[model samples]
Target: MGLSDSEILMPASGADAVRAFGDGRDVTVFAGGTILMPMIAYRRYPQRARTLMLGRAGLNQISADGNVAVGAMTTLAAIAGSGVEPLAAAARDVADPEIRAQATLGGNLCAPPSRQGPRGDLQAALLAARAEVRCAVAGRERIEPIDEFLAGLDAEPRLVLGVELERPRRAAYSSQRRPHAHSYAVMAVACAELADGVRVAAAGVAKRAVRLRSVERALADGAAAEQASAGALDGLEPQDDALASSWYRREVLPVLVRRAITQLGGG
Candidate 1:
């Protein structure tokens, strides 16, 4: 079941891509290979029957006519320069320039947690932006809220096609990292003020980035930034990893949340 023995399927269009993905039984969808290649070299990657290379699937589009829509195949480098606020900043914070240019949005969304730490740096920002993920699952396409998509990620295998979201009136992002290209963030927070209300999310505190619903509710209840940030630990169960200890993540999450919220003028 090594890669050498696997069938490599490269689809030239989105339709054919999802059709190839079908039920995702023994398929590994390869995007930028930023996360996969390392595991591959270290011999830690799982063996699959097929590797679906999505390089030419015609999904690398970025649209901003009104509501923002970004194809899953779009590179982080493209997003960093797309003027998309917290997303742009989060994209810029990923790895070094070369990695950013090669790594992709879909790969980030679908990255499983590694032994070292959590992998999806863009999740918090996208969650706070109220992004919707458009993915092909079980032979059909569906769009769901970011949180819902993440909730079922471990239970299902889906092929991400793109993400769409309405721009927030104000947004901000904050993170603490070791100042290295390969270093994952110790903790990160993103906040946005949308037409409906405020949204907040955090990363590096769980298996995946999560929406800070308690914090958002507190904010809606007229709590100050500091008060709302106190709810950062509502449902999160932080775990110790190579980058930071559980206690450290618990202590600093509120600080990052407060900083991001305050930047959005939520104070």
Candidate 2:
């Protein structure tokens, strides 16, 4: 079957913009155009983006101190070159350099789920930083926990502003890519001094990026790297792709987790 499409709505401010989300509305929100543009060209998207909201009513606004509140249309390049969390650096790890220049954090989160390594980077880093996602729907604006916010979301028609990753005591993210420049085969983020002893999240391993609770519990019991990782990811079956196998992810995940935890003074 083929597809048909209609109009584009341009929003000029944040308040009027975030309220545009609704159910049963076949609309595509445009940000850096990294994900949406290419998909449209290839005719892969099921819904037609009718309203091209062309304003930053809700996309642009960094807090006076350091908190960032970006409208759904913020771009990755903008974040990469800024003083935001090092996730931007992780995002820099994304392939298609041109795409990075046009990718937006809001787009990355709200867009369809991707298996690419960068998606993990954004989610994990944000989780580490205790990020918050602000969403507007049903004529009401509300903020949701970053981790909980993204959970169970299937990218329905909703207006998502850029994220806010609060400053952390220590946080780091690393990715292992196949050819070095291609998307990461496995990505890890370790956060310490966070409410939990250590929160480790990895992407590109399974259907959704996961936080290593076993590893966290081990560290809580004052375990060292060897014990922490050995128990944290002991028997999980990671998915295998062209770039890696479940065995490979299991092997490297612990090492990276150890390093991240160690750096945060967890070990």
Candidate 3:
């Protein structure tokens, strides 16, 4: 069917949104409309006949009580403006102000990346912070760790409700750009304090965001940030894209990783 034959649904609550998404037909959940709208208008999304818009489902909330809970509909502009650690810094580097205003956390996580590479700056920071993804399907809700969620990206549930991260003692994020007018990141790194020790994560360099377990272990064993970062890339594979080559990404990974650790007080 053509776009004109589509049915746009506006759900009033989370449950209603979940129900709409599980209606047994091709349904796309629309949040922020930053990615989906363009795809539909340009005929990129052929199955746009059923779309569930959750803009008014009361999911655009961010709370910081002990742990942080950010609704999926919360805009990147709001997150960047808050000055909240790692994530805030990551959000600041996203696109322009207009794009940020229409980009939501859930949409950013689930949307496919552009040719530049993985659009997972926030995912890296969240992984280091040990965040959780809250999702709902047919009103049945569940929370999964960020690692597990990323591991199962091929089978994500119907709707993303929110994301939760524990309060960290310290956190930092860093990314490299091509110095172009509005270039996306060539590579990005994030570090955060966890109960066990410091955790590290990276994006852009890989097809998917990933945790740097070797770096984290080396740092925990008292290795210098540079040394740990170097060791972390031993068996890793980085991607090559229009903005950067695999070799360039590999060379810059340690530098960005070192910077993130340094910003977190030599972690």
Leading candidate by TM-score: 1
- The backbone clash count of each candidate, in order, is 0, 20, 0
lDDT of all the models against the reference?
Answer: 0.91, 0.62, 0.81
**Local lDDT at 131 for model 1:** 97
For model 3, the stretches where C-alpha displacement exceeds 4 angstroms are 23-25, 46-48
lDDT by residue (tens digit), candidate 3, 5-56: 7798998987778778883247777788877777877778737568788898
TM-score of each: 0.97, 0.83, 0.93
Ten residues in sequence with the least summed lDDT for candidate 1: 179-188
lDDT of candidate model 2 versus the reference: 0.62
Model 1 bad stretches (over 4 Å): none
Clashing residue pairs for model 1: none
C-alpha RMSD for every candidate:
1.1, 3.0, 1.8
Output the TM-score of candidate 2: 0.83
Best by lDDT: 1
Instruction: Count residue pairs with overlapping backbones in model 1.
Output: 0
